[model samples]
Target: MSEETKQPVMIFHVSSEKGLNEIKKGKLRGVHFFAETCTQYLSLNSSLLNQSDIKEAAKWICSPPVRDKSDSEALWYGIEGKVLDLVSSDHAPYSFDEKGKFFMGNNPSFKEIPNGMPGLHWRLPIILNKVLRKQCNLDLHDFIRITSTMPAKIYGLYPKKGEIRIGSDADITIWNKDKKVILTDEMVVDGSKYNPYSGFELFCWPDEVLLRGHTIVKNNKIMGKQNIGKFLPTKLSDYI
Candidate 1:
């Protein structure tokens, strides 16, 4: 990762294409590579930098900062071409007070501030709502491959953990494509009150979520106990 410099301020734009090119040329070493590009980068662009008026928006702010429309195009192409493996939230929640103090002009330096934002809930929806909806030629399998199958395969969580088939755990999410609602703080705040998608309309949401063999979420509310979530053991040998 490279930092933005004020003097020249030129960003080293490394698209997935260039990275793969370097690897193919033997300039970089690694037998295989897996990369995760987040929701904020997928849906947002440089327009967000000018949205400093909205303090909460800055909460999700990241550096190697959001690029222009061109970069968005490159990222979309990367996703479509199967260069990017998984889409995750990189979920983090910070209070307005915590984020507000940095931009107060006291420090006046981008490096001094803490970097992160909240989006545990909205990550999946944004992908489905924005990227998938606009993809004209992408099939359903391609969609599932990027979001679910690839992640499981790369991390060795496949067939046994992520897929839906006989003998596999019945983990699944039934999304209601007809459901439409304008997002607001009143409705969703997993651990924080602000959402970047606040006031944005969503056409779909998960109507049901099954964890393993049990129904945990029904009609967007928890149907089972919260503490039942368990951690899985990691075996590095299986993958390496």
Candidate 2:
């Protein structure tokens, strides 16, 4: 395509070294490296689901279906080397009943299972744990860059939303680096009844979350009023 007609594409849930290389070669505009694509790919293989139990298979049923465990390390390297742009949750929530349909033989084919798993609540802690464990070479600044700064900048909220500076929104998360929590279904704040990260121990937890200078969560408990969120605008110029 000619430069005048070529539209920007944001690749989602990249799952392999080849895919990462394609993004680099094509000079793709945006790439979102999802949590499941990073960690679940290392721990779970799609083929194993065929021999595994229902619950196990259901947990592994997300899009760009988790790749071979070996591909994960290379993807991590892409992140550490700045080849990958950002990390996202792709937080799609389906109730146990919905995800269980495939297991119940509603449709035995793996392709019939819904694509996506909940991760918004778990994204922060998982990345932080990987950093703490030396599983990834990212430091706190890199974490902030990928999770907040870069995203805000890409979506046209920079200077006003992502940074710690004068005139910026007060949105922030206060993390307790020493705290640890074993993820459980009960901990999910969204409508989803199951969490893929259930039973994983995370070394850090958000003690508070602020939105526009208002305390939305304190002591890990939600304090925001319902239906209070406002939309922020974005523009094509936000692209890097």
Each candidate: what lDDT? 0.61, 0.71
TM-scores, all candidates, are 0.77, 0.85
Best by TM-score: 2
In model 1, what are the clashing residue pairs, if there are any?
A: none
Task: Please give, for residues 122-142, the per-residue lDDT of candidate 1 as tens digits.
Answer: 877767766446643355676
Error of 2 at 219 (Å): 2.4
Cα displacement (Å) at residue 124, model 1: 1.5
Per-residue lDDT tens digits for candidate 2, residues 108-200, read 566666767787887778887788777778888878877788778766788887798889988988888889889898987777778887888
Q: After superposition, how far is residue 165 of candidate 1 from its true place, in Å?
A: 1.7
Q: In model 2, where do residues sit more than 4 Å from their true spots?
A: 1-7, 28-50, 98-107
**What CA RMSD would candidate 1 show?**
6.8
Candidate 2: lDDT of 164? 86
